[model samples]
Target: MNWRPGCDLAVLHLRARLMRALRAFMDQRNILEVETPLLIRAANYDLNVQNILCQDESTDPRPLALHSSPELFMKRLLAAGTGPIWQLCKVFRKGEQGSYHNPEFTMLEWYRPGMDVQG
Candidate 1:
């Protein structure tokens, strides 16, 4: 059996460069980069999205759900007076299988306070 990574080194390097560029762009706009929990006590209530439950004996007995998005946590930060913020994190979704859709994927989410459609 052949053993090799799906992504090549060149692709990895390009991805890293792209991420760096994104961070730089956000920083230039005075947007803070933040990180939130991947596993949360509660899952998203969106009916269209399915949350993946984590079962760990060593941790709390209560089920932990993998966050489908950082929107909730980021909103909390916004309520706490945090200005524009952005996050690059891994999100999980269950019952999704396809070439374009993945069970787990990296997502870039951001929140800009006081900005609306007509801003």
Candidate 2:
């Protein structure tokens, strides 16, 4: 069996560079970086979206759903007067494993309170 990481040195370097550039661009635009909870109690209701449920021992001992996106929580932040914010974090989804799809992957979510698609 070949034991090797999926990512190599060159790819890792490129990813770092891309992340740095993204952060720089966001900073230039005055967008704040924020983090939200990955483990959530409520799952998205979309039929096409599958949530990876995990057991929470401390609480009700019921299955807690992993977040598919930071959209809902970020909207809450906006309502609470956080202004424009963006997050680069990992999200979990079930039954999406393939060449372009992974059960768990990095997701970039951005929210601007007053901006529309054109703006």
Candidate 3:
């Protein structure tokens, strides 16, 4: 059982610095940081995305899927009149493994109520 970290201390420090900078940038724009559930009842049905299913059937009769993106839940918040919001969370996808792609990754998503594509 290998217990060492996947990356070195310098990499960890760099990640921490990046996260701080991102948070600072968002704070300056008044974007609230929010957290949503990782496991949800419905899976994303996007053509190229596959969801990872939870194995613990004993907990719930219906299967739960690890969210590939926080879009759905974030949209719900937006519909409920929550102002501009941003989220930094972990997302999971099934059967994705490569040098540049992993089964799990951190995702940063944001929604501004009145912003359009051009903006």
Instruction: Find the candidate with the highest TM-score and give its number.
Output: 1
Q: What TM-score should be assigned to candidate 3?
A: 0.90
TM per candidate: 0.91, 0.90, 0.90
lDDT: the better of candidates 2 and 3: 3
Q: What's the lDDT for candidate 2?
A: 0.89
Q: How would you encode candidate 1's per-residue C-alpha lDDT over 46-97 as one tens digit per residue?
A: 7889999988869678888998989899999999999999999999999887
RMSD of each: 1.5, 1.6, 1.5
What is the lDDT for 5 in model 2?
Answer: 87
In angstroms, give how far residue 25 of model 2 lies from its true place. 0.6
- lDDT scores in order: 0.90, 0.89, 0.90
Summed over model 2, clashes come to 0
Residue 2 shift from truth in candidate 1, angstroms? 4.3
Candidate 1: which stretches are off by over 4 Å?
A: none
TM-score of model 1 vs. true structure: 0.91
Per-prediction tally of clashes? 0, 0, 0
Residue pairs in clash, model 2:
none
Error of 1 at 117 (Å): 3.6
